[model samples]
Target: MQYQAPVDDMMFLVKDVFSLTERLGDIADFADFDEDLYAAILEEAGKFATGVLQPINRSGDEEGCQYNDGVVTTPKGFKEAYQAYVEGGWQSITADPNYGGQGLPKALHVLIEEMFYSANTSFCLYGSLTGGATQLLQAHADEATKQKYLPNLISGQWSGSMCLTEAHAGSDLGLLKTKAEPNDDGSYSLEGSKIFITGGEHDMAENIIHLVLARLPDAPAGPKGISLFLVPKFMVNDDGSLGERNGIECGSIEHKMGIKASSTCVMNMDDAKGWLIGPPHQGLRCMFTMMNLERLSIGIQGIGLGEMAFQQADAYARDRLQGRANDGEAPAALIKHGDVQRMLNTMESFNKAGRALGVWLGSYLDETFHSKDQSKVKTADIMSAWLTPIAKAYFTDAGYETCTIGQQVFGGHGYVREWGMEQHVRDCRIAQIYEGTNGIQALDLIGRKLIGSKGEYLKVFLSEVNSDLVTMPDSAHKNQVSELLTELEQLSETIISRSASNSEIPQLVACDYLHYVALVTYSYLWLKMEVAAQGKLDQQSAFFFKRILTRTLGLKASIESEL
Candidate 1:
């Protein structure tokens, strides 16, 4: 199957739905963005993804990564793809220009990532993890750390990984037992192991940077005592040259169900030479900066895979001859059947809504942090926090389901390996499992974003949703969004009252509640897109409203019913 980047819709969301040309044009950094530059960037990104990455996707997966004598080698062509990626300056899209980046909008970077991820997820991990590390180091790392690491990472000379999960620790980082001891030179000795470390040890880069979480000997136990450190694979000399290998080493690469080409490893930090990024015993706070970005990136992985699945399924349905259409016309292919249309429609609705949500949220997030205006900053922050978990859990869940449904369109052929549809299914499955599993995302949504803030964040979200509906010109989706808003309001009250007596109520209802929030958020985005598209998207918008958006009513009943 061949992959084609959905450049049109991506451009539409950025230029139309978000009103980028108008809203962002006033911003000094985005003032000079022109049509030619925009087209060139997307065209080149799509070309690179298809020409460089897509060719190796299935081949790399079959080859997987190799582990020998504690050395890890990614599948054939993987390293070359990364080299092209860096040489093309793809990693600098959202980086600070001073550090050798183009400094494009992060949301725009998300659009570019969808293409790369859709083309080859394994090859794409190297770039995304490196960008995540850049964010961490820029935000929390000292000036010296930033200077030493940002340029190389931004230029993609080295890759990075987050080393938080130990054998005993998964979502509950507090249970981790990794220890960090103070050294005479103000560095620390980190001794323990981290598992499921993505691209933790790979041969593609000259160096590997690990953002590890460990605790001091006298620090308090659990999450509060944890500290974040930067443990590089090789020490750097005073003259910026590579020094001897550091204490970190890859024990072995994991044999995984999917994204097999990407090296997931068992990382051993045996008295690793490391430098602290932020204040001591305040690691969790700094880690969230990276973790939140990873969470959103994982969600986009789902959307990327969904797009790939949709393309493959849609193409196969049109070309593969099957039963005749029930409609009067003599149909030659399966796509003529109503069931086939229904399947495609389901995939299309969620993918469209999910992708739009991701891009818009990314745009809003950039504004939240970068805008000089105080009022815009405050508004964007609220929406960013509210949508972070939704983007993570909802998109991945929907993306996985989309891929499966797309596979169903192929019937038995979808199950066959040679068809390549099964690979998308396998590759997408891990998104829901990794990056703080979808279940934990639900808990984070309700327990942290909604309730932990004492309903402050939800109020902001509701206000914005209501504002969007009111401002949107009259349309079918507008009323549906209104209904969704009202349903969410009632559901929130139900959850609040129920949780008053039993705090565990969130755990019981978070899964359902998360779906409720996701459906509403997606519906709102559809309505917004429909309004912005000036009726071009009416069909897709209605498909979501009638087919999937109706689920919230049942969710409300589930949330309120005696359990």
Candidate 2:
């Protein structure tokens, strides 16, 4: 199936539903961007996604990446496509202008990102990590370090990767054994091996700047003692030219279940000369800056793949002739079947609402980063922290489900490689696993964001929801969502209270609570979209209210039962 960017729906969410332009107009950084500019940027991005990226997706997957000694080679056309991406200035969209970046709003960048992921997830992964790493360095790296690295990274001449995981440690960062010894010249020599490092040793860029987490010789134990370092693939001369290769080498690449085109490597660092990113024993804190951004991007991965899957399924359902309908004498297309319609509606509802939710979160990210008002920045920061896990876990969870439903729409054909639905399923699966597993995200939502804050995050979220509810005209959908919100508030209090006595309660109910919150969140977005559409998306809205929103009832029941 062909991949087309949902530029129209994205535009609707950005302009009509979210009103991002007016919201961000007060910020000096975003004053130049209007609806027209957003559309033009998205249009060109859509073309690149559809034309350059999508074409090589299947071939790239089929060819996969080739590993030879310490070097890893991407599949055919991958290099050219990456070069085109860099030349198009796609990498600079949301970076700082001083470092050769476009300095666009994250609200706008999110939409373009969705298009890239939707077009070709594997192809897009190589660049997505770079974006995350760029943000991390911007927020945490020192001035001199930024001057030496930020420009090349932002311009896409070089790419970046986050090196955190090891063979023994996954989500538990404290268990990591990567060692960093201080040198006489003030630099650190990192000696550790990182596994499952995406774009770790790819041939796409001139240099790969690795943000590695390791321990100092005299550092304390556990996560607190961890520190972040910037380890480049090749040593750079003072004139900004590439010099000798660094001590880091790709021991081997993982033969992954999916995203075969993107290199997932096991990097062995042997006395790799590095510079610390943030303060000592504060690596995890600094890394969260990058991890949080990557979580959002990973959430988009789910949205993008689901969009692609839905398009393929919807197109196939409309064209493929099958059994007869009750009213029709002739054999009807699969779309005529009630069951097929149900599946398609489910996929469409999630995809559209998921996109809207992503943009909604993007708005908060914009405020957190660019807003001058401290109050707005603080609230945005809280909201972003609370919602990041949901965005990562729920979007990907829903995305995986949507892909499966899309595959089911094709019946047996979806299982094969010819239709491309199965590939989407495989590709999207990793989003949930990596960037911290969905389970880990659920734990974070329940433990740190909700309970740790003494329900402050939840209160902030509900306040925002209630404020929006006041503006929406009276309707059953609105009332239902409001009722759900009230129930969620009560449920949250109960969970918090119970957690004080029984620590196991939160862990047991975290996943369900996440789903419950996500369902309600999607319902709220759907309600807003219904109002914003002025009857344009009535059918889709009705489907969400009638069929999709009902899932929350069971999720709530599960949570209550657990409590």
Candidate 3:
């Protein structure tokens, strides 16, 4: 079966819930953006996805990536297709315009990402990593560094990688052994081995620009001592031409269960030529600038996979002939059976909630970037920070389950290789593990976000939701809204209060707490979406609206059961 982009739902969320085109400030660069252009962009993105990228997703997975000696080769067609993506201007959508980027709002890019991710996750990772690496450099790198690297990265002429993890130092950066020594020329010589570096050694571009994390001499112990450096695979001249090899080599690439098309290489940096980003001993802080972007981007990845899985399952259920309906109307496809319909309905609604949350977070980031109002910007910042971990962990966690349920719709065929449903499950499984394992994300949420600064962030989130609930008028959603708000508030208070006494309390309940927040957040967004859809409901829109409300109501039961 072919994949179809959920255009109507995506546009509705962007236009109504996000208002990206309508509410963007008078930022000089964004002044020309309008609804029609935004729609056209999304339409073209969908076409590129369905026509160009989706056709190769399964093949990429089947072929995976290959390594000969130290050189890595992506699956057949990846290099050419990636070049096409670059020519299409996708690599620069949200990058700095001064560096050959289009400088568009991230909300628009969010739609593009969903399609790109859905079309081919492994392929999209190469481009996404470059965008993320470029964001880090643009924000923190020096003039010489930026002048040399940014344009190529933004143009996708060269790709990029983040070298953060070692075999022993995955999340605990304080334990890392990569070293950087100062040279007379004010540059650094970096020597280290990094594991699980996505896009580290692929031959998809002219060069691979690596943003590596290393500890300098005489630095303090622990994470405070770590610093970031721009270490390219090949040295570049003043005119941005390629020079000699920079001593960074792919020792080997990982054999992974999913996203096999994207090389996860073990990189060895032996006295590599490097330039530092940001101040000494403040690398982690600068790294967060890129990580925060990638974290949310990863969440969107999970949401996209879920959306695609739901689409695939819904299409399969509609066409696959199976048992008779419980109502005894007639023998029909699996979709006509009540149990199967319930599962598809559940999958559909969950994907909607995930998309709404994902896009809403994207909207929040857009507002954070463009809003002139300080209070709004600050509010958006706090919300974005507080919700970042939840968004990444919960969405991915749910995405795994959603994909599994999607495969269930295909039964035996789903378990087999040819069907491609299993690929969604395999690719999505790693999201929960990487980007700081979901457990780490949960710990960060409750430890740093919820209880940090004496529960200030959680208070801000709950308070805002509470305030929103008051304006919800006397519709059928009112009671549901009020109940959900109350439940979430109680959970927040319970976790916050208990975590104060025991250090382990937060960790113990964090996964559950994350689920609680996600369920409630979806409930809240469902209320908002239903309200938005009312004024603009066409035939299909009305049906979708009703389904969203039903799903929101059903979630109350699921969440309550967890409690």
Candidate 4:
């Protein structure tokens, strides 16, 4: 199945829904970017996603990656595609201009990422990790490390990876046993094995820079003792030339159910040369910065996957003839059937909601990055933190469901590999499992986000929602939005109170709480989009906006049932 970039829909969100131009104008960091230039960039990105990278999606999945003696090679054509990606300047879209990045607002980057993910998620993982690594270095690493590494990484001459999980430890980073012993020359010898390290060892770039977490000698126990390190595959000279091979090596690669095109390797750091990122014993605190961005990125991936699946299924239903409709007409394409239309409509509504939410979250991140006012930055950060897990779990869970629905639309053909629907199902499954399991994500939402800090986060979040409700003019739809807000407040109260009384209550009710939060958030965005579409409701726009409102109502009904 071929992937097509949703350029028109994305442009609608960028220009109409979120007002990207206005937001960028307000940010001092992005003051240099005008809409025309941004559009040109986005156009190029869309072309790359549609015309270049997307065509190779199935081939990559089929060929997978090859692992040899301490070397991992990507699928055929990936190297050339990656070269085109580098030349197009995508790796640096969110990086700093001081280090040769385009320095575009990350909101734009998020939109581009969605298209890239839809086109080829497995290939994009390597670039995603590299960008995350760059963000870490720019934020915390010393001037020397930043100057030496940032340019190459930003330019895509080198790729990056995150090494956090071990066989014994996944979410519980405090249990990690990777040891980093200090050396005489202000370096550390990293000795440990890290598992599930994506792009840990790949031939896609000149050097692989690893942002790993390990425990330093003489440090306290648990997460407090852990620290971040930069362990490159090949050490570089002061002038950025390759110097010597680092001690880190890929022990082996994982054979996974999905994303086989991307190598998930076990990295054995046998006295690997390393430098600490930020303060000692504050690894978890610092790692959370990258992980938080990653969580939301993965969420966008889920939505993108779902959108891709929906597009394919919708096309197939239009082309494939099936049984007659209820009107007793002769057999027509399945899309002519009312029930099939209903399924497609649901998928479309879910996809739009997910996209709008992802864009909103990305705008929040841009605000967090560019806002000079500490209070504004804090507000955006809190809201982003509160919504990150929801975005991750909800979008991905919905993606998996959408993929299954797409398969169901295909009937028995979906179960077989010939239709390619099975691949979508398989690829969408890992989004929920990796990047922290969906169950754990839900627990984090209710347990940590809602009840954490004695409900301060949830309280502040509800205040913002109420503030929006007040500003919205009174209308029937407005009243409906207000009612949803009221229910959300009540739900929050019940969850927080119940969770306080019983430690297990949050876990028991996590799924319900996650659904409630997701529905409420999506409803808010759907309303905004509806209002935006009111004056300019062409057939396409009207159909899309109405379908979203319909889904919002359905999700609202679901939330009430849980109550």
Q: In terms of lDDT, which candidate is strongest? A: 2
- What TM-score, to 2 decimals, does candidate 3 have? 0.94
Q: The CA-based lDDT of model 3 is what?
A: 0.81
Q: After superposition, how far is residue 526 of candidate 1 from its true place, in Å?
A: 0.9
**Model 2 CA deviation exceeding 4 Å by range:** none
Q: Which ranges in model 4 have alpha carbons more than 4 Å from their true place?
A: 471-473, 535-563
Cα lDDT tens digits for candidate 4, 291-312: 8778888887888788888998
Best candidate (score: TM-score): 2
**Candidate closer to the true structure by lDDT (higher is better), 1 or 2:** 2
Q: Runs in model 3 with CA error above 4 Å? A: 26-28, 466-472, 535-563
Please provide TM-scores, in order, for all candidate models, with all chains considered together.
0.98, 0.99, 0.94, 0.95
Clashing pairs in 3: none
Please give the lDDT score at residue 340 for candidate 4. Answer: 88
Determine the backbone clash count of candidate 1. 0
Global Cα lDDT for candidate 2? 0.92
Q: Tell how far residue 349 is off in model 2, in angstroms.
A: 0.9
In model 1, where do residues sit more than 4 Å from their true spots?
328-331
- After the best TM-score superposition of candidate 1, give how far the Cα of residue 52 lies from its true spot, in angstroms: 0.6
Give lDDT for model 4.
0.83
